[model samples]
Target chain A: MPQQKLESVEDLAAKAKALRRDVLLQVYKAQSGHPGGSLSWIDIGVALYYHEMAVFPEDPANPARDRFVLSKGHACPAQYALLADQGFFPKAWLETFRQYPTKLQGHAENHYTPGVEVTTGSLGQGLPQAVGIALGLKVQKAAQRVYCVIGDGESQEGVIWEAAMAAPHHKLDNLCVFHDLNGLQIDGDVKKVMNINPVPDKWRAFGWAVKEIDGHDFTQILEALAWARTVKGQPAMICARTVKGKGVSFMENQAGWHGVAPKTEDYEKALAELAD
Target chain B: MAGMETAGVGGKVGVVMDSLRDAYGDTLVELGNEGANIVVFDADLAGSTRTSKFAKAFPDRFFNMGAAEQGMVAAAAGASTTGVVPFVSTFAMFATGRAYEFVRQAVGVGHQNVKIVATHAGLTVGEDGGTHQCLEDLALMRMIPGMTVLSPADALETKQAIRAAYAHKGPVYVRLTRDKFPRIHAEDYRFQIGKAVMMRPGTDVLLVGCGLGTSICLAAADLLAAEGIEATVLHCPTIKLFDRETLLRLAKAHRAVVTCEEHQAHGGLGGVVAELLSEAHPMPLRRVGVQDQFGQSGKPEKLLEAYGVTPQAVAAAAKAAL
Candidate 1:
């Protein structure tokens, strides 16, 4: 197959809206899952898997394929939708979400699911693994890139910065990290719980190419990812400004929905709001 | 006699590095020479963890993750996902205690082919005190599903365990000590995963030990023999996939059993043995390990003695149980 070109910003935005609807439907069906962060990361997930990355679902174990790690794995609904849409597995697998022995687990498992890359749920660990993949590719002189998405609250972990420092020191140019700066976590506002302010400057100080963009904007997301590809000497960090629940009005910026699954009425409202 | 013959074939003789951490680095460097896809990683303690030697020789393959044990483990998992065998080195305390979640998710849960080689295990870390020393790593790591836990008795066994871990196609945690101890294994004794080594065979009592405690068990067996009491010493290196058949046979053959290790009695070697014996073949078992207590700053030998991990303790426990 010929190299797939980047989709138009409007098309990608529409896809994000569709993904949000799918996420709400799946979460509602599962009767258990985090919907707030899932909605927040919909656009970012679409941009990476559909536009920014060079992975082929036909061969998920392709050594040259770009790696995408869902560090904030509680938002697995976003990943499940992206994987199904990308043809990693059958779209019908999404319906099996949270069911025992199903590949579509509440948290991602690389063994059962294709294209999931690294198994993650424990917060603040995906970036380190991403760094390792980038480092490994560099060592092998392979052209594969590694993209990791983490939540703003997950940034409270010291290991993330530890990996941040090591990535640039090793000159992992194939690494691009996106922080879902949704400003909310399970407890409440991230600022009230543990301030991860100056996120961009902190990453820049650690020797990364820092970019702050509207995570909901496909055009900006595309431009930032394209810029990251051009940079050759350092890792890139994109502080993606996002709402906790971007598509659904009632759940937007709400901390209660961080880990709580939406009820039938809430799910209907969320799906209706996300319908394009 | 068979163990001696295997030791001869492997060239397992004489003063090997008493510390398993040093053996890990040296063996990794040796394994790198054999054209294997071996990679080394450390969480900023390359020198302290003794992986600096491998890092110095193969800088391209060695990654210093800088005080991030979780990241180191996760990266190792990622590397393994790509078919590269990665040996992740860190302090046992941090690797097992702090990065437990990462290891469980990325390596254990994923069943990735990553080797976690941890140093400063048990009370061997000494003066750095309880904060640095990890006397409960074996218990924590063993609890992870599909994790192969190997705590080699000495340097030679450590080298062999590293090779075995590399050969094994799954997640393996090789716990190592910081302090130097006597190299006990004969040079050619083959180290096999999940297989217990019957160091000395007798019928009166069975002394099962792992890691540093194995050496103490050997000493206790010798002491028992000197007192005209026949004792058997079994070296149980693999805590996860332990040799159940051999353990049951030894339990039936011996009059009583004594388990020893430099770890918390709660979930360490003793707990495992006790659980096994409770179901397989019940026996009067005495446990000689750290008894629900924390360690303190002192010389490693002093700490071992104070914690009742010495051969005298094992001998006493064996006698009482008998």
Candidate 2:
């Protein structure tokens, strides 16, 4: 782990605000992407990249560096923003997101993007891959940890439970996964579509060290990550309750914004709201 | 040539047979012992897939991912990112069918170094019937971009194919059978990934085969020889990384070609050869295998005969092509 001092909560919050602006801009430019999930996931993504995870943007494939997987791949604008900000690629490339021949693919393509550890556009795949990386680290007796963020909606995939069951069975203490529990999916309420309620109980039953936190709160997000490090002999799950589309006044808690790209007028209002 | 005659000669019953999965399991142990940073994952079919041998040998390196092939395949892709070669196994149906998208996205698109050695392929899966037997695995696996597809003929080729898959970087899907098969390659046979082995050197017709189909092809060659129609037998184990040069060269020498496999005729070796010949050397061609139909429960040999995947069927197809 890098011994660099953790960024202050306020600074991290400001950076997340910038990332939020970047996310909205990228989605607006692409004219196609999941802005709601991106907004919901940005805060947690910021907390991991800016403070908790030991990731080297210069040498992205450093064996000792921590790994991250965006399992809910539709929300890639947020991850793309973070990678760009971290110097994983040129910041200008964010404008090319979802465009033809752009390296910033609509979904996370690990081979195309430098810092992205795994390709995960498909729902319910990242957790198992994270588990595999953790198991591989354990086999090599390496200290590098693995981090993954999954959409609450993505939990409906049966492979999630399969990975969830396997991690604890293998005693994968080095894996830390976060659930972006934004309470909404593309098809309206997640509850109506598929109720994954009692989320903490589910993780506990699956043999993970579980924590519930306000996902938007930088302190809570950071604290949960710190707490995940203290866990031993089992993987950690941080279920973060968050509004569907956070920060923007009109978008928050709105299922309609789940995948629809904001129109120019809506984009202006959203940008104004996120402006420093 | 006489050695090739031993395969599928006096029926599949009395002949000593070798299990492809047995060779696969033993090869995994061999690879593990050679200090290869290799890991094995099985989705609750270790006993059948023969990954149990590796699991017993390297208890720590082996992982039984339960019945979750999707998770197993994805996890193997993840493990490969960390520089460990992960060999995943399950019955052919689940490995390619149950977990197709995972294999496509994680291993294929991501270009991860994961070996998917799927056992229990084709009509040879016998009593399990069509649902368990995967006749379209070759087609499914071949469609994946950058995926190396292999269908070894016998035990010796199975072992060498495993080693080749391990040595090769990127994703590879190997198709193996449930039943023990007669050996087609000589003891001195050295396997190469893209090179086809010439089992016999006749020129009346070209008989192509992979997996159990190779033995069938060799038997068809013998049957054809007795009737004054000398045929060439080409064993094509690697379906995707095919020996196009050798195939086209042999195609030039022979009057016609007959491709055989235990898979659906639409997209296994037959489809591959058709696609190749249509572009390169279009000649009188006949694909001898299961027609577009599901297999039924029966004795393995009986199933082969019923599905029109036998030597007689191949010989007839060869004669028809000629």
Ten-residue stretch with the least lDDT total in model 2 chain B: B1-10
Error of 2 at B102 (Å): 0.4
* Cα lDDT tens digits for candidate 2, B102-215: 999998889899999999999888888878878999999999999999999889889999999999988999999887788767788999999998999997999999988888
TM-score of each: 0.94, 0.97
Query: Ten residues in a row with the worst lDDT in model 2 chain A?
Result: A1-10
TM-score of chain B of 1: 0.93
Please report, as a residue range, the 10-residue window in candidate 1 chain A with the lowest summed lDDT. A1-10
lDDT of 1 by residue, A8-46 (tens): 988888888888888887888888899999989889888
Pairs that collide in candidate 2 are: none
Binned by DockQ into CAPRI classes (incorrect, acceptable, medium, high), candidate 1 is medium
What TM-score against the true chain A does chain A of each candidate get?
0.96, 0.97
What is the Cα-based lDDT of residue B241 in candidate 1?
97
lDDT of 2 at B34: 92
The candidate scoring highest on lDDT is 2
Prediction RMSDs, each to the true structure = 4.2, 2.4
